[model samples]
Target: MTNVTYKYATVLVAIQNLRNEGYNVDFNLEENCLICGDNKYTIDDFEIEQVYRYEGESNPSDEATVYGIASKDGLKGILVTAYGAYTDSMSTAMLRKLALKND
Candidate 1:
């Protein structure tokens, strides 16, 4: 993973910036993997290239994170997820994979 710090005004802006840089695919979190269209990728199939987090000014529900992910097969994509109280439920492995970076 790239250990560079990037600052964006909002999660949308971060996603847009990543999209412009060739991370076009949109990935949704599944119980044990990330899904993009018909393709499913496990943690071992992809790497987190970058991560951007946004904390709400007032409501904790507004907290979110944007991830730049790249698959071993050359697929590049973005994954947007909520944190704290609104986090998605997933398998233990999936949670560990994402939570490690979240910290």
Candidate 2:
């Protein structure tokens, strides 16, 4: 995979810009998978297509990350998560796949 870098003024801009780029689905991480409405995707079901990390200048709580994701079955989405220990916990496989985003 090739690396793509983008600079956004804020986390909201990253989310909106990624949506404009066609990552329109909104995802929430469950204990073992990523969920969107009635659909659930396991670790093997999707890949992270892009990542945008934003750091807070005055407060760490403002730090966050935006992920552009696509599933094997043709679903595309976005996942917004916070940095550090406040992030939601994930199953090992799910964690491994998401960690690959940094590579």
Candidate 3:
């Protein structure tokens, strides 16, 4: 079993890393990235961490890895993205309330 709640700090660091890279990214650890295989990260995991999206006419077939993050409603939600597929538009108000509650 994956330790979901235990990786709070690690999840935050991953998001910060993406942000520092100039990509509009967020965190969603609820997403299971190991379904493909033991110790194997699903495409969603990479997408969430790397913030990737599909190009041309074809859309992304891979679902995103979901992580726990402070959402726009002052609640935590599973973050998802596809490079350019889904960029969350979180409200600053909700942002301020979350990310530090449990930490």
Candidate 4:
């Protein structure tokens, strides 16, 4: 994947920009999949297209990441997740998949 950085001042701005770019869905991270409405997308069903990370100035708890995701079937969305201290728990495959672009 190509490396790209967006200059959105905050996580909210990044989300809005991605929405305007056609990523209309909102994906929730699951233990081994991503949930969008009633649909559950496994690791093999999607790819991370872009990642935007925000770090807090005073506290680590404010750290968060916004991911631009696209499924094989053409569905596009964004996943907003906390990093650092309050990270979510997930399967190894799910962690690896997300970590690929996060790093």
Candidate 5:
């Protein structure tokens, strides 16, 4: 597994460590996929290789998650998001695919 093996004290540390290990690109969620700059990848075209979730001891606002995403065409990146009550504003088909992946 290419997952980060050590426990990072914070989200920032985890991101920096992951980047140092080559998960350099940053991804944004799209309607039916993930996008990094002009490049896009559909649900079936990319995989979430690893996931890391962090929560603050005193504040829910500090919740965050990081996803290691890799595309079939060889692009590698990370997607950072808020943890609780977050919603994916994508089509039903795309949403279903992502949901199944989480399970």
Candidate 6:
């Protein structure tokens, strides 16, 4: 993987870890998804949730859409927060897939 990719993956992991740790973000990891902070960060328990693009026309150069599965409580909203190293042009899909396998 490229150095830039390595950096984004790191941040993604950090986000998951933070959720697991019950940080300021409110959430929990389900069997096939993660319900967190008004945002449902969707992904298998083993998958990593993150946007892989290095940059975008969006306000946040580095951004990702997180979704979670429906739970007894209900599915959380969604948050596309700014994060990771914005390189310029990169494969967001490949990066997201790689991020999922990163764990």
Q: Give the top-scoring candidate (lDDT).
A: 4
List clashing residue pairs in candidate 5.
Answer: none
Q: What's model 5's TM-score?
A: 0.76
User: Lowest summed lDDT over 10 consecutive residues: which window, candidate 6?
Assistant: 1-10
Candidate 3: minimum summed lDDT over ten consecutive residues — where?
47-56
In order, candidate lDDTs are 0.81, 0.77, 0.33, 0.82, 0.72, 0.38
Q: After superposition, how far is residue 34 of candidate 6 from its true place, in Å?
A: 7.3
What's the CA error at residue 20 for candidate 5, in Å?
1.6
Off by over 4 Å in 1: 4-6, 84-88, 100-103
lDDT of 4 by residue, 26-101 (tens): 9997667999999999999998888887888998788888889999888999998886422356877788777634
TM-score of each predicted structure versus truth = 0.87, 0.82, 0.21, 0.87, 0.76, 0.23
Residues 76-100 of candidate 6 have per-residue lDDT tens digits of 2222334443223325543453342
Candidate 4, residue 31: CA error in Å?
A: 1.5
User: In model 6, which residue pairs have backbone atoms overlapping below 3 Å?
Assistant: 38-77, 39-77, 39-78, 40-67, 40-68, 41-67, 42-67
Q: Which tens-of-lDDT digit does each residue in 10-92 have in candidate 5? A: 77887887788788899888766789999888878887776677877899888877777788888878888775333647777
> Where is model 2 more than 4 Å wrong at Cα?
1-6, 85-88, 100-103
Stretches of candidate 4 exceeding 4 Å from the true structure: 2-6, 84-88, 100-103
Error of 6 at 98 (Å): 11
lDDT of 6 at 20: 59
**Candidate 5: residue 6 lDDT (0-100):** 32
Error of 3 at 85 (Å): 18
lDDT of 1 by residue, 61-97 (tens): 8888888999888999998888653245677777766
For model 2, what is the alpha-carbon lDDT of residue 82? 77
